[model samples]
Target: MMRSACALAACWWLPLSVPAAASPASAAEVLPPVIDVAGSIGIVTDYRFRGISLSDTHPSVQGSIVATHRSGAYAGISAYTLNGFGELGGSNLELDLYAGYRHNIGPVTVDAGLLYYAYPGSSGGSYEFIESYASLSARIGPATAKLSAAYSPPQDGLNGNGNLYLAGEVALPIRSTPATLRGRLGRSSGDTPLTPGGLYHEWLVGADYELGQVTLGAAITGTDIAAAEARAAGARPRDTRPTLSLTAALRF
Candidate 1:
């Protein structure tokens, strides 16, 4: 368990899967530090990650308070809005939150943490279910390599199942230009394969361009989605199309 815990910490520092920093705020309002300080607030016009619309058809308010030090140890909370629950009016609007930490060992890093996903308004009162994630990674030259996994066990409306997500990617900078390209492939598995409880695979191949506070990226994911409603509506194949997503984010 200790080894696994450390491997999980390694996953956080490896740039391949880590999120970038936000726009700089006033020094008087907020102090920025190297290997210190922990907190941030920002908004994204759209919040889509790994081909799924995390904040569909609406703007998202995001906040994070995490800081890493020379020792590479840190902790923080990341929260965002969840538009839908994969069903029509099944649950009210939802919001998700996760707290993570990382520790470094030589060239390797480990990350681990618990995550909470909740729903508020509409149907039932505001409530949320929880999950967990652990990952490990290493770095080499300008390329940082990583292999991370997460387990979200079964729960009430979340279905009695857990998922294991495995992914790896590399990132490199473009000389003289403020841009980076990254490629990743990830697959998820669980107990069942349906609606909000299906085991499936996902692939992500994307790149991002960063200019100061604004950054943009695009990626595509392929999966099998059952379109029974479309089929019943006489829409060609019963299988839905693959998932493709493009994202533009600004941190200010």
Candidate 2:
């Protein structure tokens, strides 16, 4: 179960909200929670939990709370409050949490924190785990480049588990379309649903368009879950798939 939580957090970090969800109070110039509202909610058209679809089993909801101060110190958190998928014995799903802090040094910023994955229906009987990580971000032209590495040792070997992640994205405006295109790519090591014995290769290509008062965004992510090593190791029913997500935000 703990292993699953760690894997889930990795998904959020990948293409969700960059900077990993900060607090609303921490916004610049005494901003309101509404300022971080978009960052706080990811209405996944398909929220997959533990390599399975939750939008089908449970209307999975993921959100975050962020607080930032003038002193350059900020804290925020992200979590999954429900799952729509059914377990082996037809059990309901639960919630998961990930929170961290960021320290700023001029143009360079650093982040560190832990993630908790919980199994809801089981009376909360020790089905959780923690993932720790460090990340850095810097601005270059019209894009913000970020680098992060996180780790978590296996927990009772039940859920899902993994290792290091190298991911980056570039966000900029398209002069003609009232929209923004954010391109992302990543190389990851450790364990994944597709790669049982080795690391996996993944990439995300998505776009967000803002017109007038509403923001619309869509992304398609592809991953090699069952790598060559997994097949060689007698893995069953190869699982290589694509994940899609869409989000909307209203700014006041």
lDDT of each: 0.47, 0.50
* 153-244 per-residue lDDT for model 2 (tens digits): 55532245545556665667677777777766655566543234556555666677765544566666555655565456333322433444
- After superposing candidate 1, which stretches have Cα over 4 Å from the reference? 1-35, 38-46, 56-61, 67-73, 84-94, 122-127, 192-197, 224-252
Leading candidate by lDDT: 2
Which portions of model 2 show Cα errors greater than 4 Å? 1-39, 48-60, 72-77, 81-85, 88-94, 123-127, 157-162, 176-178, 191-195, 211-214, 227-252
- Taking all chains together, each candidate's TM-score versus the true structure is 0.62, 0.62
Candidate 2 accuracy as TM-score: 0.62
lDDT of 1 by residue, 1-252 (tens): 000111112112222222245334443234324355444444554444433344553465565555454345555445555454443244434444555667767788777777665554434432245657767667677767777776656654444545566667677667788777676665555552212224444455556677565556544443343455323322122121223223333222
